[model samples]
Target chain A: MSEKQKKASAYWKENVRYLFILLAIWFAVSYGAGILFKDTLNEIKMGGFELGFWFAQQGSIYVFVILIFAYVRLMNSLDKKYGYDE
Target chain B: MDVQTWTYLLVGITFSIYIGIAIWSRAGSTNDFYVAGGGVSPLANGMATAADWMSAASFISMAGIISFAGYDGSVYLMGWTGGYVLLALLLAPYLRKFGKFTVPDFIGDRYYSKTARIVAVICALIVSFTYVAGQMRGVGVVFSRFLEVDINTGVIIGMVIVLFYAVLGGMKGITYTQVAQYCVLIFAFMVPAIFISIQMTGNPIPQLGMGSRLNDGSGIYLLDKLNGLSTELGFAEYTDGKKSTIDVFMITLALMVGTAGLPHVIVRFFTVKRVRDARKSAGLALLLIAILYTTAPAVSVFARTNMINTVSNKEYTAMPEWFKNWETTGLLAFDDKNGDGKIQYVADPSKNELTVDRDIMVLANPEIANLPAWVIALVAAGGLAAALSTAAGLLLVISASVSHDLIKKVFVPSISEKGELWAARGAATVAVVIAGYFGINPPGFVAAVVALAFGLAAASFFPAIVLGIFYKKMNKEGAIAGMVVGISLMLFYMLKFKFGIFDGGKEAVPGLEKDWWFGISPEGFGSVAMLVNFILSIAIMKFTPPPPENVQEIVEDIRIPSGAGEATGH
Candidate 1:
């Protein structure tokens, strides 16, 4: 395989890895804690909020923002590493 | 000043500002018309995307819905915001790198088939029109209530204003105007929230105030107090949900996926200059949106708690002026079903004497809280901004699909650039008129249809676009088949279950819940349909010829982050 093709594949591999990791957290926070395990998480309270309720209404949104920014940072570095940065 | 006078002043100023921006940013070419010349900065594009994404539904009705739905409302909060994460990660960067003028442009070019593009165009048109009809209704409601204009007059005024900016300035005008609208709506939303937060819990932040102790010195958390109040009134607990867990899971997934597939939101990414800008702008848009989305639940809690405390079993004659004012609008009505003079707001429909519309939670929040009249007026302006901004965005999507995708690419491939621009403006004008008609005389099914737009988008576009990018061998035949089958299944379910077209009609919909597929409501059935679309597309692709070598190469090119250029008509 050509060097360029190999580099593209590597960059894509890293990108997909990041996506899986980030999306897992996304699924965990919203589907797992917020829904599937909500009753379990509700047993624990943070201040006045049930842990499950907080995750669903507020915490997931915050985590989503952080995850996007983190992806941006990671992608920027990856692009630079692969010389894909414009 | 009175609320009426203050509303007039603020709405007048904001309308003038939008018109002025439109005149200044008039589209000079087709590029500008379609994508604001493809040179918008990340921040400006981010602000525009936020304004476009948060419609009248988000601004006006979401808090009220959440106030009533309690824990079940988390689907909206997580669903809407979580889609941005998907867009930022999977769709936006690649689509921007493809550097297209519209979603259909990507589908048409990547799939190498006109049939794929036509299907995409139809999907875009259906999704956009259904969504825009609701915004026009929202604008009219805000106007009739706050400005004392006839609903038809309000819709006409909305149409003229949107026509001026959308036809004249196109995406350029819409983008700048949306930035201003975002500021107006968010400020209008936050001020009352902050005030009520401090008033009720002695906490300045509404998010924290929702969890803090009540200012009544009862030493009870607000949620706990609300729970007690709710149970006393025979309602569910404030933090508990009535929806089954599986239904919540499906609904949240459907909304999140649908949000990512929305044409208006996805088009905002194309307006940015580079792939990186698309990624960054998507993140910024969500951050801007999260400011309001996170505040909505808090606002809901505050509004609900205040409403119950003030009105439940309270003497009708001693009610506040705002209560009387809202009652006059027919949104807050007291029937006095019992011979007693007190209001009974219980869970049982037969015994409940007070009928409060859910929309009143957000619209009458400031008045209920006794904030200044000007603050109440600001909310009217904000609601109008939210409605108008989203309507403009949807109208652009409709116009682009019709003129650019249908006329320019398919039928009039040889049409001049200037001619195409004229066609786009004409389409926008026609779309505005149709949307206005729907607004003035909303079909009985308008609200039901709006929710189905997301479901339809989820069923049709999400799988096609994702495969068009990620799966190199996904042929047009597979995509077309999948979209047709997927959307048909969704439409069938929605009609049978939501509109009840098959089983006699709307009256039968109540009993139809027991027959739901996997106990999923029509709203959440999109998840099931989308999964089918994915499985069918891949399965069909295995038996058919792969996409051409050039199309596969195009997919590879979009994967790289560099060298995204200005959007151009092919």
Candidate 2:
């Protein structure tokens, strides 16, 4: 196959990798700390907020926001390498 | 200045500023009107999006929800903000890269069916209008209280303010004004919070104050004290969560998916100049919004702690001036049910006033803490800003549906850019008038209705848009069938529960009124509906004809975003 097709295939693989990793984290934090592990997390403390409370209120959101920016950054670089970026 | 006069002057000045910004940033074309000409920087767009997304509901009701729910309230904070991650990661960049003006455009084109487009249009209208109705009601509430007018007059005035800019300015007008509104509402939210924070705990940040030691210098955690106090009065512990574990999880999921599905928020992503910019804006928007979401839990703790300490098991005569003042607005009431002069507020279902509206907690906080009048005024202005900015964004969605989706796409395929532009303005005016009517005579429960809006969006729009990009086999028939079934299920379920339609006797809807489906509230079933939508579309697609090759090309082009490859002739 030509170099272009090979690069496009690589791009597709990378997109799949990033999406799977991010989805895993999304499920883990929101579902994991929020409801699934509430009791276990309650044992911990962050200042006045309990360990579970922190995850419920701020931790999940902070992580989700970070993942989005990271994806964008990663995608932009991938786009350039694939001759897709503007 | 007298506190009353200063409040009048302050609110008036803020209104004028919003108007001025709206006129200055008037959209010049249909594209300009819908997506701000796609030149907005991620940072500004993010702030405006945050301001637009965080409505009166988030600003006013969230803390109250938390205060009562205690640890369980985390569902809201996590669920509400978690959707942004989904939006930014799974949706925003591709949609921005697709470079469409509206959500339906993507669904319609990718699905390769005008039927899909019409289905999307219906979903968008239902979602946006249902959501806008709540914001309009919130605007009326703020206006009636601070402006010293009746609810009817307040709704009329609120309508004019929203129409002034949304009709004339479009998304461009709403965007700039929202930037200003974000500032007003955030400052108002933080100042009082910080003061209360420092007063209660040595910590100045409300987030820190929450977990910090109480003012009595007791080494015990504040959460523990709150738990003890509330349980003593028969309310659920402030620390222990009481809702069914499955239900909380479902509600959180529904809220997250619903947030991701909102068209107005997604439309904001199209305003950015590049795909990467859309990503940056998501982060920045989350940061801006997190400032409030994180602090709100602290507000819940502080307000709950203070109210329990002051009003619970206490005499009415000892109550502060703010109590009587707020009572006039009907936001706070002391029924003294036992007629014992002292008012005892406890979570104990039997003894509590059982009447405290969640919205009142934030508004009454300033007075409860005895903060000065200006801060109170600022809170009023903030409430208005939160309501108005979000109302404008939702209104833009409503207008664009008529002009861009209906008139341009459905009615007149050959409509000129200028004609489409005028049509948008006309649609916006009509939307404003209609929203005003709902605001004046709000239908049923405002919060419940708003939840239905999210369910509709999640069930109908999210599936079509997501499938359009990833599933090349999803034809127009599948898309339309999916949306119709998904939204109808949501509508029927919500209406059945709300009106008791299913019950056989005078009060019907037997199982619905007795129990929510699967213990999930009507508002939260959206996530389930969306899942059903996805399943139905995929299942049916296996038996149906696939979309033509050209539609596959559109999906591939959206995925790659290399260039404006081709324009399929309408």
Candidate 3:
């Protein structure tokens, strides 16, 4: 295999690892914390917004939007880094 | 003018505008017929997609669903938008880089199998057509209520208007028309919501108005009051949890995955000129969608709180015109349960009226808040636009799948380009007639059937397409087997309950444990099936041989957007 292709493969491996970690965080906030731990997180409050309530209403959505943008930025950088970019 | 008359006028005008736009923006070329000439900018495509994705479900139904389901309805909110993230990250870019005319083409070429492509085309048709029928039904319902037309007339009128532009403009026309539809629908959604929020919470922003202190300043949240009323009415607590945690999780996962898999939504990605733009557009489209999604729960809370407060012990004589108007549409009917002159709308089991169609709650919300009639009419137009935009998108996919994927590619590869375009128009014309028929006489469980559309998409297509791109070793045999298993399992389960296994018309009710396996509801079980698809496909591919080295090079090329220039139906 060519050196550039090998480098591209290595880049994707690192990228997939990062994606999994970020996805795990995404899942925990929306599916895990906001949902499964709703009652538990209700104990904590944030300026008239309970932690769990905020997560259900706005926190998770905000986090998802941030995650998508972050993935775009990170992926673009990695793409350029490994010569896989357009 | 009275609110009703004004609403009628605005509704009429909006339809004309939509038809006018459809005519002016119609596609003129074969490429325009297919991918809007593949020149749509990321931002424009993003708006078009947001309009396409947020259907009558979002505009008319989502808030009402959230109002009643309370915290549990977050599944719809998260699942629908979250799928876009999955699409942008895992699917959209690669699919765009594949540079295909239709999804079946990708499956056909990547798997290197004719049977697999045919299977994909069938799945796409069923899901797209079934989903489009639901949209048409929604449009018919909206038109019948607003314009005082018969439901059949409403459905037929909608069919003609849609056929007028959908057949003429193709994807190019649909994209621009969808942009206009998005504006109308969003405006329609927000105006009344803003008014209601002000009346209920004295806040201007409906989204914040939901969490704000109520007018009473009782130091209690609005959700608490709604929850109290619901529990008092014999319904589950509005904010308190009701569904099992596992069912909620699975359902949310299914919806999110299903959203990503939907052919109509995925095809929007192809309209953009570059792969990178597809990624950007997905993010922007989500941003636009999040505006309504974030506000919907708030709108539901506002509407429900005011509704219960106003109607809890109110005399029927003093009820407003909004109540009477919706009654004519059969959206709001009150049966005097206790021989009392007053109508009690509490969540109580025996006493409260059981006649509210959730669709009315959002559309009727403006008048419920005593807002002006123009806002109500705007909502009427908005609801139709939402349903029509999605219906148009689905119709395009169905037509393209038949003409581009099945006919031009598979059955008649030697057909001329002009002949293929005519075939596409013909497919669209046929789809419109069928859609109208189903709209008028929808099969039982129309709502539930449409919900299954996402499941089919999730179970069958999502895994194969994503794996085909990301996993180098995933083979044709694995793709076909995974799709067959995923979709079959979901269909078997749905048919068991929906149509009754062998009994034709009768249904047998299963106990809680029997109804759900692994605590997953049918609406959300697609995610589980998808997981099965991914795991088994990988396992099978490990034992079987991978694609040849030349195929590996194609995979590598698809990873880079620039390499897509040479690909045609690739």
Model 2: per-residue lDDT, tens digit, B1-570? 655666788789899999999999988877678888778888899999999999998988889889878878887888779889878877887788788888888887787677888888888888888788888888777777777788888778888988889888888889999999999899989999999999888789887788888877787778888888887887777777788788778778888888888999999998888777887898899889989998898999999989888777777888787777777877677777778788877655567663677888898888788888898888888988999999999999888888988899989989998898898889989998888888888877656778667777888888887787667678877788889999999888777776565664333345653477778877678888889999998888888888898877667666665663212123
Quote the positional error of residue B564 for candidate 3 in Å. Answer: 3.1
lDDT of 1 by residue, B462-506 (tens): 999999988888999889989999999999998888888888876
The local lDDT score (0 to 100) that residue B451 gets in candidate 1 is: 80
| TM-score of each model, in listed order | 0.99, 0.95, 0.96
Instruction: Give per-residue lDDT, candidate 2, residue B183.
Output: 94
Clashes of each: 0, 12, 4
Model 2 Cα shift for residue B37 (angstroms):
1.1
Candidate 3 residue-wise lDDT, A6-50, digit = tens: 876787687678779778877888888778898899788664456
Error of 2 at B408 (Å): 1.3
Point out where model 3 deviates above 4 Å. A83-86, B217-219, B346-348, B502-515
Which of the two candidates, 1 or 3, achieves a greater DockQ against the reference? 1
Error of 3 at B6 (Å): 2.5
Model 3, range B1-570, lDDT digits (tens) per residue? 776597678877877888888788878766888889888898889889999999988888889988778878888888887888788888888888887778888888888889989999999998998888888998888878878788999899889888988999998989998888888888888888888888777888977777777777686767667777788777776665588888888888888899999999998988888777888899889988888888898888887777787777789889887788888887788898887788877655566664678877898788788887688788888898899999999999999999989898889988887888899999999999999999999987778888888888999999999988888778988999899999998898777655566446455354534656776777777888899889888888888988988777778777765555522542
Two-way DockQ contest, 1 vs 2, winner: 1
